[model samples]
Target: MFTRIASALLVAGLLATTAPAAHAQTTAAKKAAAAKKATAAKKAAAARTAATKAAAAKAVAARAVTPKAPVAAPAPLTEAQASAGVKEALNKGIIKAVQFASEPDGFNLNDDIHIPTPPDLEIVKSTVGRLPGMGLVFTQLETQLNRAAEAAAPKAKDIFLNALANISITDALTLVTSGSTDAATQFLRRSTQSQLISAFHPDIEAAIDQVGAGRAYATVTDKYNKIPLMTPVNLSLADYTTQKAVDGLFILLANEEAKIRKNPAARTSDILKTVFGR
Candidate 1:
């Protein structure tokens, strides 16, 4: 009976030990499975993240490779406009010359410089002024005409300047490029002739009437016409006046041009600097 009891206790002890070993093995297997699943999930997440990053990088690269539209250039100024600029420069030169020429005594005192002389009657003025009762009247007329000319002279610049300002750059470009010495002058005459005639006519007619020198003028003109076969010679005072005004203006313009050519300061503005060039 005692032996039987001991064997039973030993069997119980063995069974208990075996059961603990089995529980430990099952726990270990469960832990390993969980670890594998977690690792797999982490790896999949990492792969997804890499793919997303690659896609983003590819999108950025594509954007960088895309080309932008080219910017357009500004349009150039037209020929007429450029010519107009040239005309403006020329007119400025004229203004400068006239201002320079007009001194205290001005045209009257400067007989050697015939620019101050009234239109088409220099001989008649000097001759008639020397005559009998005509002397004072002729001198008065001379003075009046000279005064009128000076007064009217300044107005020409305004008209000429306006014409020049309107002149197209294209006209200026063509004129300069054409290589004509008198191209600028010719252009001014063509553009402003009619306007100049209209502006100067009334003043000249009034001047002729003031001098009482009209009879003397008619006498001189008749004598010249009667000389030989001089046609009828119905010359308009307007023509003579316009011509004189234009001549004086041109003379002054040339002077101004000389200034620009010689003195650096005379090239006052930026346009002058560019046009004249250093």
Candidate 2:
């Protein structure tokens, strides 16, 4: 009976010890699993935050690269406005041109408009230039021809203004809308060329006589005629000077017209600023 009692006590003691050890192992395992789950959740949250930041950065970059829209063009002008503007431009241009051309050295110093030895008198110049003291005669004649043109330049202003005053509305509109910088000047030339020649001839002739250009030309021709086998050159100095002076006047007018058309500062009047500022 005693042996049976001792064996039962030993078996009970072993059961109690094993139960406590198993409970400790189970608690440890639950703590480790909870720590690993928390770590995994923190990693997922960090990844989400990084993704959101990358998406926001990409959006900002896209916005930075986009282009802005262009500005709209100015509105067009009315018919009356166009006509008035064109006439004003022409008027201003002619005034400046005449003033500039009438100034001293206007034609003489300007190679573009300076009258050269007449084509009709080239032979006379070439032959007579070889002679002593005769070269001065041709030089003096050339200078005097430019002087005549300069003297005749002032006569063009009245004629040009009259033409401007009489310019038809249709013509004015055509010039304004033609997209050409010198359209008005060209129109003035086409319409007033004949009138200009007629008006300038008398003044050019008188200027030539006054400036001694006629005498110098006479001297040159006399020398050429005296030379053996040279063709006698007889050109009307007034006619040639009138043509060249008119042409030079138109050139200056055209230059002024271009400036008014293309440059904002050249638009002197309110009408010109309104019409061409567009």
Candidate 3:
């Protein structure tokens, strides 16, 4: 009976020890499983963070590479506005030209338009230049010729403006957009050259008489005739001075036209700004 009791006690002790070891092994296995699950959760969180950052970076790069909208172009110019603008420019040019030409010595001092000895009468001038005391007389005639031109210059403003008013610019936009500063001036020249020549002749003839060009011509011719064997010259001082005066006025007008057309400050009008401000 005692042996049986001893064996039963030993068995109870062994069961108690084995039960604690088994419980420890089960707890260790549960801790390992929890650590693996935490590691997986951490990896999943890092992947999501990396994916979110990459998407944000991609969006930023796309924004950086995006193109801007294009700018709108200006409205096209109308013919009416173009024509009026050219006319305005012409008017301004004409006024300035006339103002310049009407001033004292405007023709006399200006080498560009100062009347030259008639191209046909170079021999007459040469003969006169060689003759004694005729140099001074010829100088006087030259001065008087310029004075006649000056006298006729004031009449040009009215004539030019009248012609400009009557004439039409067939293609004002073509002229204005031609990018040539002298386009408007050329238009004025082509339209009014004939009328200007016609209108200037009578006034020029009168200016010649008024400025004593006849007396100067007589002095020159009389002195030339005295040179003997020189062909007797028959010339109209009125005709020469008139054509020259018209030509000079147009030259001045061209300068003024360029000023008004190309220089912004010379625009001096709202219409000009509207048309050329582009």
Q: Residue 103 deviation, candidate 1, in Å?
A: 6.5
Candidate 3 residues 1-278, lDDT tens each? Answer: 99999999999999998999999999999999999999999999999999999999999999999997898987888888888887888888898888888888998898877786677667777867777877777787788888888887888888888877755655677777878878777877888877877888888888777887788778888777777677788898888888898899889888887777668898889988777777
Give the top-scoring candidate (lDDT). Answer: 2
**Estimated TM-score per prediction?**
0.50, 0.76, 0.70
Best by TM-score: 2
Candidate 2, residues 189-255, lDDT tens digits: the string is 9999999999999999999999999999999898888878766778999998899999899889999
* Whole-model Cα lDDT of every candidate shown, in order: 0.63, 0.90, 0.82
What are the candidates' C-alpha RMSDs?
18.4, 7.8, 11.1
| Clash number for each model | 17, 0, 0
Q: Predictions ranked by lDDT, top down? A: 2, 3, 1
Clashes of 3: 0
TM-score of 3: 0.70
For candidate 1, lDDT tens digit of each residue in 101-147?
35433445545333333444555555444556655554554554454
Error of 2 at 150 (Å): 1.1
Evaluate residue 210 in candidate 1 and report its C-alpha lDDT on the 0 to 100 scale.
64
In terms of lDDT, model 3 sits at 0.82
How far is 198's C-alpha from truth in model 2 (Å)?
A: 0.6
